[model samples]
Target: MREFKTENIEVAYADNTIIKNLSIKIPIGKITTIIGPNGCGKSTLLKAIGRIMKTKNGAIYLDGKNIYELSSKDFARQLAILPQSPIAPEGLTARELVSYGRYAHQKGFGKPSEKDKEIVKWALEVTNLSELSEISVDNMSGGQRQRVWIAMALAQQTDMILLDEPTTYLDVAYQLEVLELLENLNKEHGCTIVMVLHDINMASRYADYLIALKNGNIVGTGTPKEVITKEMLREVYHIEADIMIEERTKKPTCISYRLNNRKIAVEAGIKKGIKVVG
Candidate 1:
């Protein structure tokens, strides 16, 4: 099992800094969820760790070694990342796309080896795409397409996987379906899963470890019970919410929410030299 730790990393796009100096240690062999508001740099952090986005300052360490020190193939073997919107090449079959995962292991241009073919078949089967394997990715539904991409990542056979908003375009039921599949992958294979989630309730329910971010900064990192508190909701989201516990899962759920008008009213009061009361 490979764990990841970052040290004071700063991620930027052009002149805009999406993530400030941030340090985090993701536990080995557990499902970790990174959650925050829309512009909170959650995806930037995921990409940085996956080496898809470069950090201007500081380093990301995978399995205690600096990630930059590892070769591309070595890094791919240790960790894999799936982005929010992956563009599949037109006319690429699901099986063909999944087979790309084996590229890192292939030597000097030969056809897929027997072991590679076995892995690709296993990935397709595990993702329930055995029949869809020959179908074009463009012809699949959103959920099915997402599963195909996930199958590719699984074929990579990395110890850790990173995904940015794996359930974005799907409906609530499909979202739950995808999350359940990820939970199974983590449990059955002992894979370390890290993902960025926009849904707080879903993140709380499925995550073994939760990391909350705000304004490109860390807010809280712990179990859902510790990070999904009412106070945390107020602080990170500026939303007044009622935190409820699910009966069976015992996971923290936000049953109600309303805008915290206090901030706006307080600022208005200050402008008029009037103190606002709660």
Candidate 2:
């Protein structure tokens, strides 16, 4: 497993900063979820951590060494990233696509070794895609194709894995299946898993730690039981909600009950018993 530390990191595009002096430590061997509203720099921060974005300032350290100093191949060996909305080449079979993950581990003019094949096989099995290994990627459903992409990342066998919105475009059942697979990876192989999640309930249920962001800054960081309070929800998301504890899992579940502006104005009018034409 690997520990990542971002210090005073900043990213900008065309004079508009997307991330500003943000810093956070991704815990090793645990699931860390980054959650925020749309355009809140969640995806930008994930890209910065994976060295996919050009940052204007600050540094990111992986396993106590500067990530920018490593060669591309060496960095790929240590880290693997699955970005949001990845494109796949047409007509590639599931097995063929997963085999590409061994590129970083092979020598000049070398084919996939026994160990590489084993890793790829295990990844396909874990993702429940072993039955479709020979099927073309273009012929699969969206959820099935997503699992294949995740299997490719797992085949890389890196110490750290960064996934941006991994559950996007998936049905409710498939979403839970993917998250369960990730949880199993962390628990069994002790890999560091950092992902950007849109569903707050899933983030709280699956992650060991949570990081809430707003306007490129961190608003809260802690375990779900500690960080997902009513006050933090109101401040970070601008919503009034109640926190409920699940009896089986004992995790905090948020239930938002705030009225919209129009509803609030209507309530006020009713309180005064005034009826007027619009």
Q: Top model by TM-score, which number?
A: 1
lDDT of 2 by residue, 51-139 (tens): 99978999899878888899888988888999997888999999999988888888987988999999999989988999999999999
Q: Which tens-of-lDDT digit does each residue in 29-97 have in candidate 1?
A: 899999998898999999999999989999998767989999999989878899998999999999999
Alpha-carbon RMSD, candidate 2: 5.6
Q: Give me candidate 1's TM-score against the actual structure.
A: 0.94
Score each candidate by Cα lDDT. Answer: 0.92, 0.87
Query: Per-candidate TM vs. native?
Result: 0.94, 0.90
Off by over 4 Å in 1: 264-278
* Span of 10 residues, lowest total lDDT, candidate 1: 259-268
lDDT of 2 at 86: 85
